[model samples]
Target: MAEQLAQLADDRALLGRTSTAERVSDILRSRISEGFFPPGTRLSEDSIGGALGVSRNTLREAFRLLTHERLLVHELNRGVFVRVLTVDDVEDIYRTRTLVECAVVRGLGEPPYALDALAGSVEEGRRGAREGDWKRVGTANIHFHRELVALAGSERTDEVMRSVFAELRLAFHVVDDWRALHEPYLARNHEILQALRAGDRDGAERLLAVYLANSQERLVEVYRRRVGEDG
Candidate 1:
């Protein structure tokens, strides 16, 4: 009985540790998306661990997770840093998203689950936008599109789309005016949601394509201008 109780305690401890690591990862990822840790910003294990009241081991695990998501780069001997999104990265992600997302929509015939998920995300984004929470808005925006892509019913596509959005979040940080960059899209997202709800998959796909293309262009311009200013 004592042995069994000890084993249970060990399992609880492990679960608690894992939960802490996950929470650390989520907070760091959100900060990265919000531009708190811009491209090339080095993350010090000791400093970050201290700030978050986590152990160095936990912080390292969180860093590894973010690196896998492409939001951080782990350099040999140099340490981990926030990844800078190159123009090539932006273009490639946009192209891939367009292809996969459009295909997902095309194949989704009256997928109420997907439609409802998208709508829910859009409403959340609207609320976030109204509350002036650009970071939350950005997250909701990704969630909406991610749900739409999940309609493709391909686990592989979902994985690819997740990476694409991580990279896109880096690009979003380049915009100086966060609200300006995201506000205009809320209404467009609703339009897409309405079309999807109405079972107009083709129309939704077309609108999404245009919306993504325009968003890419705007983000690219913002990145260029910001880079120029920094230079």
Candidate 2:
């Protein structure tokens, strides 16, 4: 997780004085969602604290916050590790996305209402594709969904989705082929973006619902296969 620490290092000034733990947790959460710390990887308080220039107490506080979010687990006689998501957990996350993301679209008061955040995320994914960086593509995909939920203009909703994406990354890390999992979605995301740009709000909502449902099914199938092979 050295790379994870470096990212936090780069953004160190964001911590400020107040709510330091929350800021630390945000960086750690981003690392998880970006797949830097994959599922079940042990997170050492000493190492992370040393790297981020934070105290062990602050780092532990961040771990505690993530633990509450279901992104980290504290094991007996062991250190904190990234959570390994269950199939049920995956399904529940998808369910949450349907209600949260699709509702954002359904609640739109006007068509062709697009945020640069969403457009920028799509651009990021395309650039990732050009570089053959499937992990980057996956991260951009999560950002796209986050931008979608942000349309509701709710800080509380964004907070909920952040944890959701971090947990989803657990399943993503186990995929046998990252490109296969992420490449197809690039164009799909573009289509969703274009729908919004073209004032096709209902179309966008329908597409997202189907896209999420199909993704859930594929994740379940892939997860079960991994379980069988491991067994």
Candidate 3:
């Protein structure tokens, strides 16, 4: 917790003078998505506020915004904590991913689509693998999909999936074997990128559908076992 507080202090520079609840929530959201604050960890209002040099009211409002995004939850008496996803939550997240992502690919207007960002994300994952940093690999994998969604060119879709993917990270944080969960997708993401580069949108969409299905199945299996063990 002390380490996390120190990290918050480091990020305080990002707030500068704006100091809005939205900016505070963005910092907290990024930290949460990065697995710095893992699932079910209580968010200390006083400590976080002090660390970020924000008032208690400002911090609470930031917490309230995160709660709306389903990244944090407020217990009636206990306090706010990072959310722990359920099996059904995992299922629904993948469902939403499949729907939105596949449609984005299918709806692409023509070949030679803007794919540099997507390719970069795939390379990022490969670099993480070379470094034996499976968590970084996992993050790069999410970055690949987020870039894929960005191909749609819709801010609203991007906003919605931003929340969905952040929630997805909460699920990822619980899995013990990061390599097992993330390594296989490195090639699949590259495959999707190749199909897009070749103007094979159909093939790309098919590959992505299979990729997401397999991933969801594997994660839910592990999630059930892990949640059951905890119970």
Top of the candidates by TM-score: 3
lDDT, residue 197, model 2: 90
Clashing pairs in 3: none
TM-score for model 1? 0.79
Candidate 2: the clashing residue pairs are: none
Model 1 vs truth, CA RMSD: 7.7
| Candidate 1 per-residue lDDT over residues 155-224, each given as its tens digit | 9888777777877888887677878888888998999888887778888888999999998888777877
Winner by lDDT between candidate 3 and candidate 1: 3
Could you tell me how far off, in angstroms, the CA of residue 217 lies in candidate 3 after the best superposition? 0.2
- Among all windows of 10 consecutive residues in model 3, the one with the lowest summed lDDT is 222-231
User: TM-score per candidate, in order?
Assistant: 0.79, 0.88, 0.98
Q: Between which residue pairs do clashes occur in model 1?
A: none
Find the candidate with the highest lDDT and give its number.
3
Which has the better lDDT: candidate 2, or candidate 3?
A: 3
CA lDDT of each candidate?
A: 0.78, 0.86, 0.95
Q: How do the residues 25-113 of candidate 3 rate in per-residue lDDT, one tens digit apiece?
A: 99999999998899999999999999999999999999999999999999988999999999999999999999999999999988879
Write down the lDDT that model 1 would get.
0.78
